[model samples]
Structure formats: structure tokens, C-alpha cells
Target: MPRTALAPDLSPGEATAPRVQGWCPGALRPMMSGDGLVMRLRPRLARFTREQILGICDAAMRHAAGLIDLTSRANLQVRGVAQADWPALIDIFGGLGLLDEDTGLESRRNLLVAPDWVAGDDTERIATELLARLDELPDLPAKVGFAIDAGAAPRLLDDSADFRIERGAHGGLILRADGRVAGVPLAAGAEVDALIALVRWFADGGGKVSGRMARHPAPLPAWAMGDVAPGPSAGALRSGVHALGVVCALPFGQVRAEDLAQAVRSSGALALRATPWRRVLLEGAAPDAAPRLAPGWPDMDVADLAGWRVEACAGAPFCSQASVETRPLAYRLLELAQQGRLGAQRGAAPAGADTRTVHVSGCAKGCAHPAAAAVCLTGRAGAFDLAFDARPGEPPQTADLGMDAVLARLGVN
Candidate 1:
């Protein structure tokens, strides 16, 4: 796809307005947190070329905190940027062809693509078409998003989105509203039109609710549910992959810029695709080449269950809204979970058991994993609030327990 021409009016001042809460930050309109500006970059297709990756890392090191966050949405965020450096950073992104020509177009381009999509595949075609027509989309809420899961097996069911386009049982494309089980089938090459119609319908009050399509109770248009197979199991890909290139995870979805840069350089991979599950699909690396590219960056082959189970947000000093530091505690919690120490006693089983998912949020917002987890630890005034099989804001089993007390209670030494 050719790059859209840069809009003359584009400037740092024209970035999305700041919100105290509930909204995501973008490159143009970054959110101010305790640890400097939180600037998010939404790649066109959840992809980054090796050069692009190195450029981003360099930018982060010079203009931001040198930390690159692979968001659950499969986007990359350059966190901890200074106010004065925002313009320079934006210019750097523009030079890298990362920024959209129009600010509104950029914010509305909330898309998640299956990382395994190959060239000229259904996923790549449909995603590229939808992005080209972003101007036609209705004025939906900032967070209302779309997903293109055209892989033989769906891969983004866990990822949040207002609408989803996936392959139906018959191998035809289906445009499904987020909450609805059924979807209207699209004729060959009609995916973009149907998707636009659905968005327009929603904007015209077809769905009265403002957030995700699932949250709205409005009935879906006449469409039949196809016998679509369930999505593939969620986790890092098996080490010896057959079709797609090697897939691996960055521990806790955190990676140092230099480490990532070195990995990309050593792997000899042309590009990297970020997945919603916090794993990165190296485009051309073979099974043996993956580890050499990013050594010490935990791979699924070692402690697969523990690496995929735990998630934590940038809390405390990094985020102004957080009451305590979360990542460190999350690491400790994951270590205990892996050892089965923080198990049934904490109202949850071990990592590989039924309770395989864990979320440690610095605050009630649950920025890391918005969905309910098998075990949830939310910070409250430097103490932790415990919730089981529930999202934040729901009633908790205990509140305001210090880290040590909570650990002891969970039987973690």
C-alpha cells in the first residue's frame, strides 16, 4: 500500500485532546503520566520492518524512556516522553512513515490484524481495504475498534473490538458484530462495503450503546451464524513451527529497546508482527534462529505456562494514576504462580491448571488486561485488592492488603 500524503495541517497541537481517563493515547495526542508522555504508535498492520524497529528503538532511547511496550491491541507504545520532545518525536515517526497523514484518520484506524497473515491473503487484503476507507467510517467512540481474523483459525477472539471480520465455516468472509454470535456473510470482495454499512447502522442508532458492540443490546441485522470453528488455543506458537515463522513472547510484554533492536538485527528477519497475546511473529526466522535473535527473552519452550499466564500494567512511578508499582510485584506473583505457591489457597489454581490467566493492575482501571482474569491483584493505596475470576470494579475478596500480607495469604513464600 502506498503512503497517504501528509496533511499540511498536521501538527503537534492538533493531536487528540487529553483525557483524564478511559481513552487511549495516540502519537499525535499523547497522555501525560507520572513517567513522562505516554505515546502510542498504531502500526498499519501490526507490523514493523527491521529498519522501522531499529528506528523506533533509537527514537525511544533519545526522545522517550527507552522502553517499548507491545500493547494488548498489538500496537507499540513509546512510553516516558518529555513534553518538549513530543514534536521532535512526532517528526521522527513521520519520517519513518509510521504516522498517518490525517490525525482523525489515525485515531479512527483502530485495527487488529492476525499476525500470521501472508501476502495477498484474505487478512492482508481486507485490512488494507478497511484502512484505505477509514474516512468513511462513522464517528464511533475512540475505543470502538475492528479486528481482521482471516486466518484459517481465528486468533483474536480474546482481543477487544467493536466489530470482527473472520473466515466463516464455508471459508467465505463474515462481518460479525462484536457481541453477536452470528454475522452477515460477504460476497467476494464486498468486505469493506458490508463493514461500512454496519458501522453506519451503528452510528444511525442501530446500536444505542456507545462503547463496544457487545455492550449494546441492539439486535443485529438479518444475518446467519456460520459454523465457524473456534479460535486456536492462545499462547506462544509451538517451537518448531510449520507454516508461519517463529513466534515468541517478550517476558511480561516488556522489552528493552536495545534488546529488541539487537534481536531484530541478529534474526535476519525482514519484519516483525505483534500479536494481541503479547507474542511477536518473526517474519522469516526459522525455529532455530528465534532464540539466537533474542536470547534471555523468555521463549515459550521454557516455562510456557508461566510466561503466557501473567500480565501487568505500567503502574506507580510510570503511571500517575497508579497507587503502587505493579510490574515488579507481577513478576514475583508470576514466579510464585509458576511454583504453585500462589495457587488454590488464593482462590485460584496453578498456571497450567484451569486458572491459567493472571492480571496485576496498578489501579482499578485494569489497563493491562481489561478482561477478567483467573486471579486479579489491583493496587489500592500502596496495598493490593484481590479479586477472583472477575474484572476490576467488581466486589473483591479482600481489600488494602500489603504485598507481603497478600503473598502470605496466597501461600507464596
Candidate 2:
């Protein structure tokens, strides 16, 4: 394969300026990170067949660095591909039915489907309808997305989305925007039409300037707002078995490609489904199959895996903006949990509380976990700034401490 040409003025891996990109990467248009080109793959209805997953794993090992990241939008991103290998990789992806017709449609089809939806369910139906109408939508910002969370209750409330189709107060459907508390009542089969109208309204009414529906200053039209409120959340999915399948956690939202392929094959799962909570649902897999799927995969009934509670980004050499290597520190935190010293660690939650209390960012951007964590360690100039009960970039409780000093401050031995 031939390499894509870089700018004439800049050599490979050299840039005149440092900046974060606003657009998300896709199969056709990948983002260049410090490690390599990052290509994102979005499966239809957030699912992949067993064969498709196997093909993905094989391709990653041959073309990239064999590393795969499960994104918060319930998508998969293959990291560390060289410029010369992208064309072949894209061909593989297209054969697997993963690519859109073109980059324009690819960028516009940012839909997040409820992972637990069964075939022919309302969630699947709505998502399928919306996907077919992608060409009708006006150009949207790269980050703009839609959520089809019409499960028994909303499951994607915490995930990012601009427009949402969720269950109404009375079990009917409703269309709501990200920032608002209310939603417009939606009739069955009219979900897609309602969504298209809402999107056009946003685009024509100065929403392009704001870039996000939540940040758009214009008030929604009166007809777009109704008294209906979305149903209560079903809550985050954990590493366990459910009626539909087995849910397995991906430590820090990452997995080696071979391990994933092995897990899928071993479980005899008909397909794979992704959730924003760093978990994967093996559709049609037996409830007891989790323990036997793959090594390092968390099975809730077997043993507690502290990696599920921690969020860390690709730090140091993998990311140009990072000054510290984050995963190593994150692993040390896991070691503390194994040593039974986790409770004494600062920001440790009480028993029965949400255990995902730690966030280790490569930089203040907080790309790994956007929500506030009980403890956030932001990298700065080869050291770390510790913040308790806050997000990254907030004033830290303590600043400029080496790793050892940080552990000492946490009262670690």
C-alpha cells in the first residue's frame, strides 16, 4: 500500500502547532494521534456479528498495533495504524459491512442505540428508521449525535447525544433535546419524521454556530416542547448476566483484539453489542459463559476487578499533550484494591456506592472520562495535580507532585 502524502512543509510526526481536533475520527477520515492514525468503526445498531468481530481482530493485528478502544458512544476505534496500511484496512472494514457510502454520510450517522434492545424491539426499529433517513438530514457538526434509548426506561441518559428518542411518562415515545427536561410526544412509526424535523429546525435556527444542541442559545419551537418527560433511567449496565445476554466489562475501555475475538468465539455469542459504560453484551451467549470467555474479562460473580472502577487515557508517548503515563498509575490503583488497601485511598467511595470513582487523565482535557470523578489526577509538566470530587482542569487540591509523592499523599505505604 502507498502512504498518504503529508503536508509539504512538515515531516512525519512533526507539526508547527499543537491543537485538539474538534471532529471525531471515522473509517474514511481517521485522526492522527501521537501513536498513529485512529480509525473509528460504528456498527449498525451498535452491534457486530461474530464473524465480523473476528475479521476486525485479524485486521487490527495485521495492520495496526492490535489495540482496540471501546468509545463512550458505543463504538470501536482501532489505534496505531500506519499511513501505508489504512487503505487495505479500509477495504477490510468495507467488506465487513462497517463503512458508510462515503465520508459525508459516515460523519452524519452518529446514532447511539440502546445495547440491550432485542431484534424487532422499539429501540431497534427507531434506530433502523433513523439510519435509513441519514441522507435527508442537513449537514450536522461532527460531534452531533442521536440516541435511540427507548428501552423500558432510558439507558443512555449519561451518554452524549444531541437528540433523543426515549419512552415517555406513559410508556409512549417522546423526542427530546440534550439540554432540555421536556420532550415532544411521538407517535409510533413517526419517530424518524419527528427527528428529521427537529434536526432541520436546529440547523436552520442558528444551531450551527453553537455546534452542540445543548449549547445552542435558541429556544425550541413551542410545538417541539411538550409536557411529556422521559421515563426514569434504567441505570448503567454492570459486568453481569441479564435476560438477553452476558455483559462483560472492558478494563479502561480497551482490549487487545485477539482477546476480544477469542471471547466472542468461546462464548458462542451470535453477535456483540457495545454499551457506553465500558461494557460489552454478548448477545445470545449463555449467562454462565462470562467466566470462560477470555482472560482479564470481568465476571461479576467470580471476583471484583478494580480496573472496571478506574478510567485512564492513553498518556505520555501515545498522546502528544500528555506529560505523564496514566495507565501505569491506574494499574497501581488496581494493585491497591487487590491488596485490600483501596478503602483507605483518598476518594474511595462508601460501600454500595458507585465504585467508578477514579479518573486518570493524560492532560487536563479529561478525554477518558468527562464526568466528575471522586478522584481526578491530571497530568501537568511531567507531574500530576490531584483533585478530589471534581473534574480535570478544576483547581487541584494539590499540584506538582511526582508519582511517589502522590501515593504518599494518598497515605499509601
Candidate 3:
């Protein structure tokens, strides 16, 4: 389901406007928090040097919200920060030499850094260059995405990006366009710029997209190819990721400054990696990690781990524009999925304890996912639209099921 802007644009804004409207409801530019820019971080890169980890924690506490939100994309977002600290943090990022300044190219560059003892130098520089080029992109074709997967840990594999590059390319770096991950040789040092140009060209031609596609999204680029885009991910979510040692949903996808400090202070764990799955991947832990889980700490298993699986946009709390809580709805749908009625009735689930992927959105933004899911619950004023993929080429079979009714229908009291 597609998410609609809070109050229809009455007259929409520019290329980057949707991000503001989509991620944030009312801000024109990124609002500066007290110390850092309130943004999300990707966590696939988990091994932060002890010094780097400590410095990040200190900066996050002093400048930003002191809270970190790990995302499924392996990105990290420090919230509650004031605007003043942004430049300094940006500088700090520069000091760490991890800051890539590509105006308005933030979301466009989901560069995957390898999660090994030593960061891949080429991947790092390439990611920086990609960020610069992505920034130069006036407005990427909505459908285009660019990723430099240095085959990072868990390897940011098969994401919904318009283009992906990795070390194993037939060429120095292969470019996967139009959905396939086949390496298309770039004119050495030309991959990043070529992609920026490609997306710009597509945007000029009218391609509106947020992530990658499983196949060509129609019209031009007949030769492009990419793997099947993954569903809303829960793997990198801090509040939602699988416990490095335990299972728990991170509260609000954030950790208290004190908690973070404690995690950092603990022996052995020397680094932090933020993942799009919304979880913090603590690196350099003691030989035994079982002793590290704080008592009474939230259990990762309690959550509808798949909450991230349903790609719903920020619906209520953060997005005042949203009419409801999309994550919660997605959670409910996942639980209802346990009922296994849809697949069971349709012969889709396994014998028992099956997991059926579902996407629930507060509105239509559908930030969590752009591709279709087995089920989608879109919230509307006074009710919800319960729908499912009846089949491709066929209209979606939908009903006027509101939240309560939908819940009841799902067999959840």
C-alpha cells in the first residue's frame, strides 16, 4: 500500500520534498536536534574501533539525543539532538573520516561497509565518492538506488536500490541497474558518476521510487537486472533486531545514554554498528556474551520480530501527520499471521508455527516497503483498509475492515 502525504500537498514540493513529507511530516529541511541531526543509521558495519565507539557514544550523548536508533538498513540514527551540534558532529564524523557530504544524497547512498576486523579501504572511499555524487543528483529517479556493497557482514544483500556495486564485479566495480545484480563494467572511476547521471536521467523521465525493484519497473532500461528485493527487515532494528545474545525489541529503537555508556564500558565490546533492522550490533564483546545482557532489559523475542517485515511508514508518534501507529498494526498483523489462516486457508504456510510476511501501514506512505507483500493494512480516517494480493494482474481483494474488525478477523482478541 502506498502512503499519502499528511494533507495532500495541495501543491507538492521539490524532488527531496517527499523525504521530508515521508520520513518527517512537517519539516522542510532536516531539523537540527540539540546536538546532532535526528536521523537513522545503517548498522551493517558493526566493528567500531574501541576509541571510535567510545567517541561516538560520547558525541551521541553530548550532542544528539543520547539515544540511538538502529535501523534495518544497518544505519544508525541519534535523536533528540539540538541543531547547534550538527556541524560539530559532522566535523566529528569528518575527524573519524566517516562523514560523506553529498547534499541531499543522504538516503540515496546506502553504502554497505564490510563488517570485518579492518574496514575495506576501497569500499570506504568508494562509499564517500558515491555519497558525493548522490548529493550532486538534483532529484534521483524515484525508483533509482545506489549501493556499494563491499560484501559487508550479513552483506547488505539484495536491497531495493536502483544500482548496486561490489568487489566481485566483472569489472573493477559492477553496476546493477533495472533490478539485476549483474556487474556492468563502468568506465573506470565512472560507476558513481554514471549512476548519478542515470538516475537523473530517469527522474527527468518520470520515475518515482524510494528503493530497488525486483525487475525493470517498466518502459526503458530493458537490460537492467537485480535480485528480489527483501521484505521490510527486522534484522537491523535495535528495538527489533535479533539479540546478539538475547531476543528483545529495543524501546523506541533507542538506548539510554547511560545504557549505551554501560554497553561501551563493559569489557571486550569495543564497537557499535547500527543496522537498518533497528538494532545495535555490539562488537568486541567478552569471550562469553551471556553475562552482558542487562537484567530486566527488554527481550528481543517478545516483539513481533517481523514488525520491520511490514514496511509501514512512521504513522503516529513521530509522524504527527500519520493517523495511526503503523508499526503496532504491523505487529498485530504478524501475530494474527500466527493464526495462519490466510496461508492455511490458501495452502501457503508450513505445517506449524509459520511466519507469513505482512505489511501494515498507518497511511499510504508505506515507507517500510515499496514492493507488494502478502497482506497490507492501510489506515484511513475512522477505519482501515484490509487488503491482500489476490493475484498479480488482478485487483487486490480488499474489505472495509477497520482496526477492531481486522483484529477480530485475524483471530486476535
Candidate 4:
């Protein structure tokens, strides 16, 4: 569901904008945060060549805070970018073929592809066709997007998208809506046409007012509803060797520029593919490359980890809207894992029971993890409000406590 901005707190006759933002950041149009700027890059097919990867790392080190964030949409964000250096950084990106010069086309080409797609597969072909026909799309809302999950089974079921191209129970193609269970069946190669038609239907039906396809209340057209169900989920992809490459986890979906460059060099991978799950697939990388990345970086092959399930935003001084620091608390939670408080908690009992998924949002905006988590700590007036199995903006079970008080509530000394 699309989240509305929290109501602003204002005095009589005084005015202020709501703390939440509606548009997403892009490389051409970045967002201003407590940090300098957040410039997001949506890589083509969520894959980056070696040259592009090295160039991005170099540019990040030169023009930003040297930190790159992997987002839930399988995009990359360069943080702490100075306003003065924006144009220079963009120039560098253009040289690397990372920039989409047309702003309208870039915004309209919001696509999420299955990372495991092989060349000439349905995933790549449909995504390529849609990219070429982006100009044909109507002026839809910015937050709306499409997912091409035409692999053996849909792997992006949990990721956000307005429309989806997935496999049906009989291994045929289907164009599914975000909220609907069934979808329109498609001929083997007619996915792009069907997707375009569905998009047009959404736009003609006042979908812009809803801001996202899932939230659009209009019923689907008669032709758009095929009674067949989608194929079973392919499950979450973890860090390990696969037929195409080696997957590695990025703790908190963040990586230092230096470490990323080092991994690229050490692994000698031909390319890197980002995923919504905070894991990167190093294409053509040797299986042993995972261990060579770093000690702190776990590949999930031999390491029992919980950091992959924790989400934290840039807190306090880094974000103007945040009242308290968040990452430190997230790290503290990981440290507690050493004490056997939550050892090897991944894939165990559900979230609230064993505290598997944790989100430490700097403020109620919950920029890091918008959905509900097992444990949530939301910042408010320099204190923290704790919630159990809730989103950051939801009412908390405990409120108005300092950091130490929060620690005590979690049973920590």
C-alpha cells in the first residue's frame, strides 16, 4: 500500500511542509537530505559492467561521501554529494553510459528485472522492448513501476512494482497487476504489447490520482483478468555460487566505495548485478571469490548472520528530519548476536517471535524500511518509540524513552 505523508505539526498561522516526500531520487534529479544530496542510479537490467562499476566507485570517492546504497528497487544511490559537484559527477556518469539524458524517459522507465535472467530469455527480451517503448507510456505517476520476472518462477514477488510479467502455473506468460492475484495471459512474445495496454488502461482510469497502480481502486478491464494463478515463488536468493555467478550480501544494503572496488578487482568478475534483497551477484566470479571479499562481509554460504535482516537509515546529523542516531543501535543489535541472544536467527521463527527482522528508522518517515518489521525503533524528539511487528509510523507499544531505556526494554544491560 502507498503511504501518505505524516501530518505536519504546526502552530496557528505558521506553516511547514510535511516531513515525508513523494518523489524518488534520481541521478538527474536528486533529493536534498540532511546529507548534501542523494543521487540514485537505476542500472540497466540491474547489472553493471566492470568498467561502469569501477568508474562509479571512483566518482563516488571523488564527489560524494564514498558510500553507495543498494535500494529495495534494485537501484544504487550515491550519498553525501555536494551541490557544487553535482554537474561534475553527472558528467562522469554520462561518460560511463549510466545517465539517461532524457529526464522524462528516465522517470517513465521504472523497471525491475529478475537478476538471474540469461541472455535471450523472456525477462531480458520483454525488458528491452519496454525500455525502447518508454516514450509510448502515458504521463503516469512517478512512483509507479513495472517488474519483469519472466524467469523459471517469479523471484520478485515481495518487491514493489505496479505491473508484473510473471510465469503462470502452466509455465506460460502472464501480465499481473500489483495487488491482484490473477492476471492477463500473453502469447510467448507479446508481453510488451500487453504491458503497454495495461498501462494505458491504468492511466485512462484516473490512476495518476492514486499515485500507484496497486492503490488504484478501479476494477481491471474484462480482458485483463485471466483466472490462472502465478507460478510458485523461487524463494529468496542468498550469497553463494550459482550457475551465472557468486552472490554476496551487503550488510544494511550499504558498501564503502573502496570495499566495492576491491571486491570487483579481487573477484575479477565480469559484472555485478544488484538485487532488491541487499545481495549482489558478481557475474562470472569464482565461488571462492565470496570468501575473499572481506571478513566482515558474509556470503551466507558458511556464515550464520542476522545483519542482512536489519535495516537502518542515515540518522541524526546525517538527516535533517531525524532526531536520533539509528545505525549505532542497529550495530548494537548485531553485537548482541555474539552473546547468543539471537544466534543464527535467519530463516528461523517468524519476526515478532524471535525478533528476526529489525528496522531502526531515524524518524517516522521510515526511509530505510517502509514495511513492517519484527522490531522497530522510530526516532521522536531525540528519544525512541519501540513497536512490535509494526511499521515505523504505526503506534508504538512503548513511547518516549531514551536510548538506554530502549536497551533496557530489549533486555540489554
Candidate 5:
């Protein structure tokens, strides 16, 4: 494939200017990041064919920074694009059927489907139905989203969402509001209607404090049903008739465009699915065989619990808001934790303490993994402030620890 020509006289200030906080980026209007412009593409049905993947890779290398990021919402972003090249890049994405004809429609289509959904399954059916009715939904908060998790067991509860349509215990469809335990029982034919009604209720009666369904203060509709039991923890890899592929992470959720493009081409899989867990699902390939396609690809096995335990933001030079680099530190911490180096020194955590997960944020904003972690590191003027199982902005246990000191505290020599 031929490379696209770069637009002339693009400057750093023009390309990397800050964007509105909480505003999501899309192909039509990309957000400016520390690197450059970031154009996010949400693949319909959370899927893309091999051809689409290749085209995206080519476009990224040709017009952007040759880097692509898999977002927590099961979307892909081509980062570090020049301001001048955005038009050509958007044109390329449209050619790949990646852009919605109307930008409004694209923004409203924040739906996540079960990555392992098979043809004719409840997940696929309901997602398709809901997608078609997106025009009917009222204007919602930019970050508000929905999850369609109709697998035998739910796989997206940990993912951020304002509403969810998941499998009920009795094997029926249930539409549940986020941050609540119960959901209204929905029959096969009425799922879409119930979802729209709930969305309407939120728009009409929800409080001003937060647009999220969890923060809404109004009473739920009378049609609401039974309490929802939480699903089993998401395993790194799943093997079933519906889900037969491997799930792998990008070292702190960053990937070179070329590396991913080469892997997909070599895998021979027809499609790829992004997961909210900072992983990619290679459909139609065995777990063991898929990793061979890309050298240095980290395919997390079921037993690799450490790999599933760390989350970090794109810090420092890549994010204008950041004061330090996050991913490199996260990678180091993960290595030490996996080797039992940290565990050996700190001893077993208190019963019920969350010792498995660690979150590294670039600044106090905590853009990545906003929730508390077993060990949290927030950056401050190139050093770090440490906290234990606490949210960002909470006072740190120890302040202003340099990189070496932070590593020492983690018991990493």
C-alpha cells in the first residue's frame, strides 16, 4: 500500500493543542493530545475484518504517528496525527466504512457488545436492535455508555457503562441500570423498548450531579425486576463454542501500529475485537497459536494473574496533563509483582485487601483506572506520590518519592 502524503507546514502547537475535558474524540473531530491529534474509531458491533485492520494500520502509519491505542470502551484510536493530515485520514477511514455518515450518530453509538458473541446469539441480536434505534435515544452525557453482555455469563460488569443489558440468572434478558444491583426482566422482543424507556427516564428525571445512571436520584420504573447476582471474575482467556480465541494485553495498553498490523495479517483470523480490559480478542484462532504471529506480543494465560492486575495512563510526553511517564513504571512494577518480589517483602495482604491490582496515573486526574487500587501512584512534578487503596486527590501516604524511591517502596531492587 502507498503511504499518504503529509500535509505541509504542520507545527507542534497546532497539532497538540489541548481539547475540551471529557469531550470524546471521533474520526470527524479528533482530540489533540500531547503527541498530536488522536482520532478514535469505534468499530460497529465491536468488530473489524482483517481488511479493515490492515487499512487502519496503513492509514495510521501514513498519516498519524504509526501508533494505535485500544481504548477501554472497545474502541481503537490512531494517535499523534498531524492537524493538516486529518482530512485525508478521515477520508481513508470513511472508505473503510469506519466513520458514521453523521457525526452525531457516531457519538451516540457508544455501545459495547460481548467480544465473544457468536452469530445469532442474544448479544448480537440485541446489539443490532439497539444500534438501529440509536436515533431515538435522547441526548446523553458524553461519557455515558451501554453494555450488551449476553454471554452464558457476563463479561463486562467491570467496564464503565451507564446502562447494561445482560443475561439474567433465569436465562432471560435483563436491562439493568449501572451502579444498581437489580434490573428489569425483559423478554426477547421487548429489550429495545425497555432500554429506550430507561434512557428516557434518565434524561427526564436524572439529577444534575452526574449524568451516569448510578448517580441519578429518581425512582426506577415499576416494571423493574429482580436483584442481579454478580458474574464470575473475567478470566484472561476463554475457551468455548462461542468464545474460542485468545485475549492478550498491550504492555500498559499501547501498541505500535506496525506490530499490530503484522500480527493480524499473520494470524489468518477473519476479525478482531477490542475488549474493555485493555486487551484484544483475535477471533477464529487458538490461544496458543495466535501469539506466534507477533514477536513480543504478551498473551496473558489464565494463570498469568499479574498481567491482568495493572493499569496505567499514557503519561508525560504523550499526555499534556501528565507530569511523569506511567507505562514504564507500571511494566516494572508488574514484573516485580509477578516474581513475588513485592509480595515477599510486603507479606500477604490483610484479608479482603486488594493486593492484586495496581494503578499508575500521570496526574491527580487519574484518567486511567479512576477507581482505587491496591497500590496507587500519582505523579507530581516528575516524582510520585503514593497512596494505598485510595482514590485520586486523596492525601498520599508518602509524598514526592523519586522513581528509585518509589521502586524501593514496592520492594523492587
Candidate 6:
């Protein structure tokens, strides 16, 4: 179904603005630490060598917050930082060539390389050079983004990237945006500059496109979705149970700092990738690897077994606009689900086929998803919308139910 912004109590005109920035009257709450200037430490990296990612996880747990967010783009952010420590963190990342603050171009610093590009001969070098140049570009668009992918093997190539740099007919990197190839030709070094220019140009002409890398149904592009991705910018193909597993979030994407820190400390010799999917990818635990440090691994497939889907913004306790605690509702749903009130997979459902996803919103501002879900629960007007996502432009299937009644619909009451 296509996305249409909705705010329960709004007048018709207010429907167009996003619930977060657009409708939430006080969305710009300060996220400052003691020193105050906001925690704005931007890092740069063409690729994460096995060693680098592990070291980063270690440092993140030690210096900043233990939580890492894998953005829709193949990038990571460590939150819970103290403002006074910003400069030092910047220096640490800068020394590793991981942090950059070239304001004019740095804000637009995200780029995803195909995972195959990870093992390719020239891919890493190309990625490194391209990134360095991105930081040096004349201008940066707060909205522009890019990707580099090629003959795909995994589900990741389908990831939506504004500028997808692919192999041109001449063996050069081609720049694509909003799904269309740029009209201009670019040499390898000029690729980064051209990308920056295109993003700035597009941002100037269009409405805000998030730095996220997924496709939104709102806008349509002239170009065909192509086959090529900057490697699986975030996941992998290592063989072993521990080699690859997702860090499952408890329903509405919240994990206690203590639990997260313990996991970080206990990891024996693995690298973690924070995923927008509300989990972490633990690498290096394959068969030939060292033993895991934790008592048990997180059953990454539990949600599928439980046959329930749920997502939410860091509302209430975290965000000021939240009138209700979305995570709590999400967990309650999970509990009812485990008892068989809701459906669970009879056997493991093949990946990507999980039919149910429960989205709980603090207010009407649905920050977690661009469109309505199979079930949309909001705190604002005190209602829940049972949707089918089966139709094109229908306001989600109308079911005005209370929290418990909504739970029972999924057989979870």
C-alpha cells in the first residue's frame, strides 16, 4: 500500500506533514550532554575490515553508549554519549580515519558498497577513495544519498539507494539517483563529486528524502530498479551459527544498556553490525571460530516462530511526543503471542514471508514506518486500525479497538 501521512486529530491540511517533524508540535527536543552542542560525531569508513568492526564494538561499549543503530543506509551510530566527550570521541575516530566533519559535504557522507565488493580486488580501494573525496566535495545536501552495487547474490541489492553507482557499459562507475541514472558521465574520482552535486541538486528541487536507503512509495522515478548494490552493505555469508545472527530487539526496539553492555563484553571474537531491522549481526562465530562468551545466543528466529510482527519509535520515555509507552504494548503482545493466543509459524517460514507486523505508535505520529501496517495502533485518538495492506489507497482497514481488543484480534488477548 502507498504511504499517506495521517494524524488522527488533525485538520485535512495537516495530513501532509510527517508525524515526527511535520506534525509533532515539539519535535525538536534537545539531545545535548553536559557540555552542550549536541553529540554530532560523524564517522567515515569505506569498509569495515573484520578487525575494525570488532574494535569499534569494543570502543563503543567503553566510551559512548552500548547501543548501536544500523541506519536504513549501511551506516552505524552509537548513542547515549555525553556532550563533553564529543571532542575526544571525534579525535579517536579521526585517528582511525573513521570520523570526518567536513560540514559542506560530510552531512551527505553515507555510501553503501556491495558485499561482494568486500572481497573484490579494487572495490575497497575504490570505496575508500570515493569516501575521502565525498568529505571534500564543495557542497553537501542534507537529503542526498548514494549506493554502489553489482550483480547481486543476496536480498540486499534491492535496497533503495538514491545514487546507485554501478558498472557502466564502459567499466566505469555510473551514478544513479531516485532510481534513475544521472545524465552526466563521471570518471572514478569525479564519481564522488558528481554524487555530491546530484544530491544537492535533487534536494534543492524536491521535498526532503531521508538519508535512509529504503524505497518509499511516495515518489516514483523514471529509471528501472537495477541489479547491483554496494555489497550486502550490512549482512554476510559466513558459515556457522555464530558466524551470523541478528540481535533481536524486544518488540519495539529497546534493549537495556546493562544487557547490551554485557553482550558487548561477553562477545569472544565477533563483529557486530547494528541493523535497522532492530537487531545486530554477530560475525566470526562460524564453525572454526572461538567459543561464544555468553551463556546462550539470542534465538534470532523467535518472532517468526511466534508469528507476530511489531515495531515502534523510541516514544514516551525517550521521545517527548509519545503519550503512551509503545514498547510496553509491543511486549504485551509478544507475551500473549507466545501462549498461542496469536499465531506462530508451525515450522520456520522462509525468510521475508513473515505476514504479521504489529506497529505501535506513541501518538498518531508513526515514525517507525512510512505507511500503515497490517495492524496500526496509535495512542492519540485512542484507537487501532486493522489494515490489510491489500488495497492501493484505502485508509487502513477500519477497526476501532482498545489495546486489549486489538491484542485479541491477533489471538493474543
Best-fitting candidate, measured by lDDT? 2
Candidate 3 residue 173 C-alpha distance from true site, Å:
4.8
* Residue-level lDDT tens digits of model 2 in 306-392: 433677877876566789988678777666655566554556444544444678887887767666777789999999999876777
The TM-score obtained by model 5 is 0.77
| TM-score against native, each model | 0.76, 0.79, 0.51, 0.80, 0.77, 0.55
RMSD of 5: 6.1
Residue 111, model 5, lDDT: 90
Is 3 or 6 the stronger prediction by TM-score?
6
The lDDT for every candidate, in the order shown, is: 0.72, 0.79, 0.47, 0.78, 0.72, 0.45
| Candidate 2 clash pair list | none
lDDT of 5 at 180: 83
336: Cα error in model 3, Å? 11
Model 1 C-alpha lDDT versus the unseen true structure: 0.72
- Model 6 residue runs over 4 Å out of place are 1-43, 46-68, 77-98, 115-122, 135-140, 150-156, 167-174, 181-255, 274-279, 286-298, 301-309, 315-325, 331-357, 362-374, 378-406, 409-411
- 118 in model 1: Cα distance from truth in Å? 0.8
lDDT of 1 by residue, 59-122 (tens): 9988877778888798898887877788788788888888876557777889988887888989
Clashes of each: 0, 0, 64, 0, 0, 19
Assess candidate 4 and give its TM-score to the true structure: 0.80
Q: Model 5 over residues 112-151: C-alpha lDDT tens digits?
A: 8878788889888889999889999988877788999888
Candidate 2 lDDT score at position 14: 32
Cα shift from native, residue 359, model 4 (Å): 4.2
Stretches of model 5 off by over 4 angstroms after superposition? 1-20, 207-209, 225-243, 286-288, 292-294, 297-330, 343-411
- Candidate 4 differs from the real structure by a C-alpha RMSD in angstroms, to one decimal, of 7.0
C-alpha lDDT (0 to 100) for residue 395 of candidate 4: 92
